[model samples]
Target: MRWRIPLCLLPAALLLGAADEPQLVPDVSQREVEIQYSFTGADLLLFGAIVYPDGRKPDKPADIVVVLKGPEQSIVMREKQKVAGIWVNADTARFRSAPSFYAMASSRPIDKIVDERTAAIYELGVDKLQLSPSSLNDSAELSRFQEGLVDLRNRNGLFVERPGTVEITDGVLYRARLPLSARVIVGDYTAETFLVQNGRVVAAAVRDITVRKSGFEQFMASAAENWPFAYGLVAMALAVGMGWAAGAIARRI
Candidate 1:
């Protein structure tokens, strides 16, 4: 389902009015996402506006936190146990940076929009991700391996947290709806936007998305990543010429 809008518009920090400095005019409903092969998932919307800063629109009520991140791997997470009875894999935790897809939306519920040290400093939920771990365990074994790596990346949907899925209107538009399944995971993705008020973070924005893998699944993923030994010798000579043409059509049927 090809769709790629987003034709340049991110050089607007000219601060048209520049009052309290709040102006995140983001946008993204697909800006280069082509993962073919019956790829059945995608729904990003992340609209924006929030100009404010004296240019009107603001009588309180202002808090929109949307974050859609992906790309930044380095994980290990293991903790099984049971051992002799079956389980196994004792304790392990590598996580030096995780976020191969993480979504968070809010217009409320982020602790009433800010606090808890500004949502653990920008991590804004997913249990305040910012996963560390590279050694020094303890603290209940690093909170049981960071709650088993956020419960195995939230049951393999690559972690997601939607609190009040943002949706401002009168206060100067704003939207959200970032969903992208089918085990999404290609590369480069970021769409942060926070503006909160009283609790801080007056403004902030960032965008950039790419996803990838297009037609014919991107030509066999670029021939197994740029000709891996001629794509394993042409996939073993086409699996031995389709097993000798299916044994001569099963001996002429």
Candidate 2:
């Protein structure tokens, strides 16, 4: 006698045979974000599901790390020193590729979940960011400049790190929330998810997000970019008009 498996069980059998490593399916709350005149900020939800081989959760729960990174730009970092009772630029360090915005969320403190090497490789923490220095060769100088840049951006709410923020459920689903600063520049961004188990990154996935200007802000940005001379004239006229109006009001008062 010959027996055949049921159709529903066929899929399970196939998965059991084909599945070896875990996989990540990730998504972001918003694919496109518009920055208008009243734009304050936004909270982005990064969620995903983890698919393990044979549809079985590992005995040891895995960890999740989510990173939201904005476009890269070349930046010059200036160090100011008091000279003759006035602060002036003393040294400058240029970075070839530095992230305009970067925020990271992890299930636990990065040091608790992964070693320094692993953290550095994946940039799990803000301090692990790899800002490629253009010219500086001295290790100590480069480190100082990098720290200064990170500190400046942190004060501006551009670089952020939140530990113990990612929530994992049933060892299969995970979610994290990251904030977008109002000062973020318009560009393409990426939300990356990593599944870490046994101190190794098992699977990773990414979702794209776009931040753009809209309405009056969009029009102004376009005008400034496409018609620089006209925009400059308009800006000067507005400045002068505002100044005159303020002076007139002060005189009348």
Candidate 3:
């Protein structure tokens, strides 16, 4: 949501010895939306996708994991010359799954949001819908990646990965199945992109997320209902790749 840092002014007497003393402060940054979707009921799925306008392409057929980030907007400060500083403020309150604080009157309908519209509450689906970078790779060895992810999910009070996570290979799409508990909360849930090393989490990309059942779900329902096949292929391919990687990794061990 809106994160503010208070500034403490130095007493005039304290600065008497310093003729030209200057102080710097953390300025506000821009905000961005991570994901947008439609869902219903406490039992819902998150729909997300990343837009990569420009980047590198690898042919190694690497595994794909999504990590959403804070809202599209974040606070940014600019230092113009030596004596002047600029501050910019933004938020991700509009996105359904922003990392900012979320409040919908506490008792309002899930679709309705009454929190800071110009602020971030919690990060939305960490990067699934936000186009964040991949947090894991094969050569970067570590441990307890999956377990850590499970723990993170548990601590966040979530039952599974944000709905609608997709993987793209050679321009083909795939879907992912995330685990979730029945008692998961109905709010933002942070997620990560884990690098699995020997069946554990080694490296990870962290993302703040939000979860709710609202109009966004309804929007996706129409789209998903029309082209479930496209979604199916993406999900299947991701599964096969993960499975193959796991098996191959075991052989090496």
lDDT of each: 0.83, 0.93, 0.33
Give the Å error, residue 71, model 2: 0.8
Tens digits of per-residue lDDT, candidate 1, 1-253, equal 9965455533343334454577788888887787888988688888879786567776688888989888888888877879568988877878788788888888888988777987998999888888777874577888878887888778877778889978888888889897877788798898888888888888888989899988888898899999899989999999999999999999999
Rank order by TM-score, top first?
A: 2, 1, 3
Question: lDDT for model 2, on a 0 to 1 scale?
Answer: 0.93
Best model per TM-score: 2
lDDT of 2 by residue, 198-223 (tens): 99988888899999999999999999
TM for every model, in the order presented, reads 0.35, 0.86, 0.22
| Model 3 lDDT-worst window of ten | 102-111
Off by over 4 Å in 2: 1-18, 236-253
Best by lDDT: 2
Residue 174 of model 3, lDDT score: 25
Quote the lDDT for 50 in model 3: 25
Off by over 4 Å in 3: 1-56, 66-167, 171-174, 177-182, 194-207, 211-253
Which 10 consecutive positions of candidate 2 have the poorest summed lDDT? 14-23
